[model samples]
Target chain A: MLGDQIRTRRELLKDADRRYSLRQVAGRVGIEPAYLSKIERNEVPPPGEETIKKISRDLELDPDVMLAMAGKISSDLQEIIRKRPLLFSKMLRALKEAPDHAILEVVREVTDGDW
Target chain B: MIQLKGTNLVLRFPQVHPKAKASIEFMRTLRVPNDGNTYPLPAGLGSFELEHIEDHKAQLPEDWLKRGGVMLPMFQSEAMWISFNGTYPIALKVATGKINAITGELWTNELTDEPQNYVVLSEQPWLDGYAVEQGTVRQFVATPLGSGESAEEQITGEAAFGGIQIQAFPMKREVYKELFESPKLTDEVQQYLEIPAFLRRCSEPAMGLVPGGSIAQEIHKDEYGLDAWDLSAGSRCFIHTVNSEAWSELTDLPMPHKPISARDYKSANIPWFKYYAQDKKALPGSAILQKLKSKKEKPATKREDAEIGQNMSDLPVVKLRRSDVVTEGVF
Candidate 1:
């Protein structure tokens, strides 16, 4: 599914007339054509955090979305969550219970204006 | 110790020689002048068109000719601050016609690029300058070389030629375009990201002030500090660049690898007259200058933090230095 998302986004970038090329994207990711082709075909189970981050940057996709598709979490956020499990659990529960718009607001606040 | 294979951008002047010249001065920025105005290009200081014999192109020394570059005609006392047409770095080979007895070179307002190392004359202080946000518009006043007090400091033995060859590469574009309020980074990266935004706003191709997509960056030298080249204070000159024989006794840097390209002489990319248009980059930008992308060039009082080891996170102003401090002569 993550592979599908990447392919879909790649196509979208092309359709929109943006400068997106498989080679250019792969070059930015520092990978070979065969490997990227395999990734898009879902033959590989997705890569590690670093590769995923590179993919996210080249594809202009969300890092968290890419990580989730690969069944992983950001080491930075994970470290914080692991350090204070109870607080994080409570915050997660509150986030899950919030409305969609409220959750977006929470993300913006959490990212300190970055999101 | 160096070899430059190519240039990033070229500045080609109008095919027809414009005989007009202008003499604008940088009347005091700090300590405020008696005429209480902070901004604007002061009274009596306006762009003028003068009549003079014009060389179609610069006659670079024999060394630079092989590398090839564009040229523009310049007149004495005429000064103007160049702006970056866009957000990229560049190196330039700026020169005027050679003189019979004296040779002239480009001057700068940014202090850290070892200004004294290139100073062929003294008392030709950067006629005047002012800080514009995180960037500056240094007064690049034209003077006939050797007209001012000349120093026998011997920075280079390659025939004290005139005109300037400087580069203006800062950090990579990704780093420069980041918002100023972004997170703090390493000292080196911070310094690399210290270009002022206004410096990139001289003219727009759409506006028709400059030609095409090209934006001009400062291509001169420090506004002050001609004292660092004092041989009496034990200033080291790399013989590899000077002359194998004269610099032979002073071996500070490694020997040059091969023939010196035009870009090699312009190694001072530090906010000097180097810039980017649509497709150009300052190959090896002053270690390179600001044009990166902040809004203001700081004042002298605030630039203390812009020094080595100190995190220049927040600075109000930046001023040109008169002597070597943080870099210890980084020429």
Candidate 2:
């Protein structure tokens, strides 16, 4: 039964990889295609928070898109954004427009919020 | 299009950058005055280190930035070669910073990511040329907002950037050819493989140098080197992967809780690839002895094939059975 579950999980993840070609994913997410392929093969795990947000937006995936996988669990930082869409939205806006310091401000806002 | 022909690889870039033009001059510095020996770094030509910086709102302008942004430093360690297929668009970003106990380096520096669209080689008429191909970039144009009205929506369009062919590997042209026997692959193929390798290598935890599991398959003595495999196998096997954007998502997770950095890492399994301290799977006694001993179970000889095609039986797969448990204080 455990083996069966593992097979199912692999199939599901494979579906995600096929759903988005490396080029298409890079276009939507802003990461390069070669790096994307690395993730699919599990050579490396998913990238950090900002990269994840970009991937989520590019793939139009749920905020917990990475939660579907194994290895390292989602970071508390990601959990904060997952639980609070407003904060995530504000963070994205800042990344797009604010200066480098603004990223810290977004981090502060997320950390200060009620969990 | 400028074609740089080597024994193994052929590279063609549609655009060229001004820095590449400068690199030609830079290459001269690397070349020996009379003996023609390329000196090592510092004395060879110039050298710089790469650093990674993270800033949420940092905007990159057209001009080059000495340091800034979500930078991924890359080096052309050893000898490098470049050429243009048509026109070339070249852009280079260099990073530098001091080492830190927390993350090794603060990685606080990053240059802009704009490609140099043109080059003017005054001395050498052959080298002096215009870029033939355009680069890929998306631009957003916003209309002005009215005094008492909402702002106008922005419009995006595709514009032509310069294209230039470039490659940097540990081996030099002649030496690389001698080492590999066959020529190196075209820049197009190398670029396709190298970029991903760079991101994964630079970002992932440092462990080993090998990119993936070096699985050895038995080589058969047939009329054609790899003909039998193709005849038996209909479709070639290929390992598909997730797109870069989805992969980058893993980086956002908290330090300890984040997914594994899929880039290369040392492994306990497959010591032949040389990732672990404990070695297993010892090499079999060589072939000469096999003739004396009664012929029975012979180990497979893995032959390297240059053909770029599909073989269902020989699909490449990276088996990452280990879990990444980030201990406290490692980050």
Candidate 3:
């Protein structure tokens, strides 16, 4: 699924403007073209976080989205979770089934709330 | 179902497929001069702010509340274009004031092929206005309701509605998997396999879209057949356009400032856009739409050219070529 997302975004970008090639993208992200092709085909697992970040930058994709699809959390997020793992785990589980608008309401409240 | 994310409306069909997602955003742009000359694609300044009618039920009319959709504010004579983004293929029907933008017919719930009434997403990125010709579209310029300038008024002899209506249908699951899930199917094979294919008016001040100057754009024919769309699985929404003054009175939100003039934008050397997809086929112009008179052809309303400056003759345009996936990068 991670591979599909990356490949689809790349193909869309290229389709819109003829901007990049798979090989060119791999080269820019410091990966072998064959390896990148394998990743796109879902023949292999997604690359490491650093490589994904590089790819995201080149493709102009959200790094958080890429990292989430790769099944890895960013270090900063991990640090935040480590601070209060139990509370965060409960919050995450509770918000799992909520709709996007409800989740957005929570985000808005937090953003505007007085600490 | 439609979810308001910021200013964009994200339409998701979970029943159809997990990847069935599409977004619609009304982009603000410079209102091209209707001086009897077609122009290039204008730059997208930003998305218009959208608010749910349910949130402001007390201020809006009963009809709008019953419609239960979103609304945005637009300055008189302001121009807009609809931008679309989809994760997978989607069939979208866009109508302004209950008039089909593609076929120029009264709003219909079903899809037809004799003269396709809808546009397929992922192939068609943005729609500026009515499909007047094979490779040209009239720009959407906002005018006040009851001014006899809206397409709805010109076509149906009434300004009953003054907003946009949209419906989205996702591709069937089996068809999607057959086309996209299999890794063996290349882009070329996918291309080759496919077969060729509003609301009540107002107590509050309202704005309706009218045809402006023509622009070089194409409405791509549906490569997928009619069967590909799951008619059973569809979602529709109504987007009401309110005049800026009434919008502020009702919602208590500040209206967006007027967009830069075409002359000013051209003087700043901002590049206009031109998209080209040689493989895709463009639909022929709609006779009904072609027959309708443009804003320039009719007598100018009192509110038409208050802010519009002199029309510029030439503009700087950037050409966007189709992607070449087959080409390999030189190391």
- The candidate, 1 or 2, that scores higher on lDDT is 1
Off by over 4 Å in 1: A15-19, A104-115, B1-331
**Whose TM-score is higher: candidate 1's or candidate 2's?**
1
Q: Top model by TM-score, which number?
A: 3
lDDT of 2 by residue, B68-102 (tens): 21221111111111111211122221111111101
Best by lDDT: 3
Model 1 collision count:
43
Ranking by lDDT: 3, 1, 2
* Candidate 2: Cα lDDT at B42: 11
Tens digit per residue, CA lDDT, model 3, A1-115: 8889888988988887665789888888999999988988989988888998898899898888999988898888889899999989999999999999788765531010000
TM-score of chain A considered alone, across all candidate predictions: 0.79, 0.40, 0.79
Poorly placed runs, candidate 2 (over 4 Å): A1-115, B1-43, B48-57, B61-331
Q: Give one clash count per candidate, in the order shown.
A: 43, 56, 0
CA error at residue B164 for candidate 1, angstroms: 44
Which digits, one per residue and each the tens of the lDDT, describe model 3 over residues B177-227?
Answer: 998888886664354222110000003377888888788889999999899
